[model samples]
Target: MLPTKMTEALNNQFNNELQAAHAYKAMATYFSDKGYQGFANFYLVQSKEEDFHAMKFYHFLVTMGEKPVIQGLLEPKSVFENALDVVKQSLEQEKEVTRDIYSLVTLAEELKEHSTKAFLDWFIKEQIEEEDAFRTIIVKLSGIQEGGEYFLKMDEDFSQRTME
Candidate 1:
């Protein structure tokens, strides 16, 4: 069985993952409206991935003999000044998620929840990859000026991303 504190934190993390999915869907909508189909596709995949992450937590909670709580999600931002702005916002969100994940790990450690700690190890690595992916895109976008051929090419590249 899971400790109450750990269970509560996991529930919050599950909700945060759902919020991330919502935010990514909003970002996808923004890109679609701007005619950046590739960027939109990428964000759509990201949103799906976030949903998967949330479900993973839900399943983990259940497997540990704990009930998972569902919570309401806030409205995600639908507008962005530019594609770069969207990428920047994504990076910021990833950073926030990293912090949240770290907090969960810390709490699990404090309680000596070995199984929970092992499970969170995957998320810790995932957070690193998530941050790196967004940061890499931010760097590439920063190098390309607005409305440039390279920027459009990058958009095309992003669209090619498929769920792995």
Candidate 2:
């Protein structure tokens, strides 16, 4: 059985994951509207991954004999100055998620919830990858001014991304 505090925190994380998925969907829509089909596909795949993450949390909570409570999600921002702006925002969001995951890890450690800590270790690694991925995208986008041959090439490269 899960401790009350730990269960509550897990539920909150589950909700946050759902919110992240929603935000990525909004980003995907923005990319689609801007005629960046490759970017749109990337974000759409990202949104699906976020949904999978949320479900992972949900299943973990249920397996621990805790009821998963989902909360309402805030609307994601739809406006972006450019592709770089979107990528920057995504990086910031990933950082925020990493912080939250760290807090959960700290809490689990303090409470002596070893199993919870072990489960969260995956998220810690995942956050690192997530941040790195967005940072790489930012670097690539930053190098090229929006709307050029290089930008189009980058878009083409992104379009090739597929969920493994």
| Candidate with best lDDT | 1
Q: Model 1, 1-164: lDDT tens per residue?
A: 89999999999999999999999999999989988899999999999999999999999999999999999999999989998899999999999999999999999999999999999999999999999999999899889886689988988898899988
Candidate 2, run of 10 with poorest lDDT? 155-164
Off by over 4 Å in 2: none
For 18-92, candidate 2 gives per-residue lDDT tens digits of 999999999999989989999999998899888999998999998889999979899899999999999999999
* TM-score (C-alpha, index-matched) for candidate 1: 0.97
Q: lDDT of each structure?
A: 0.94, 0.92
Query: Over the full model, what C-alpha lDDT does candidate 2 score relative to the true structure?
Result: 0.92
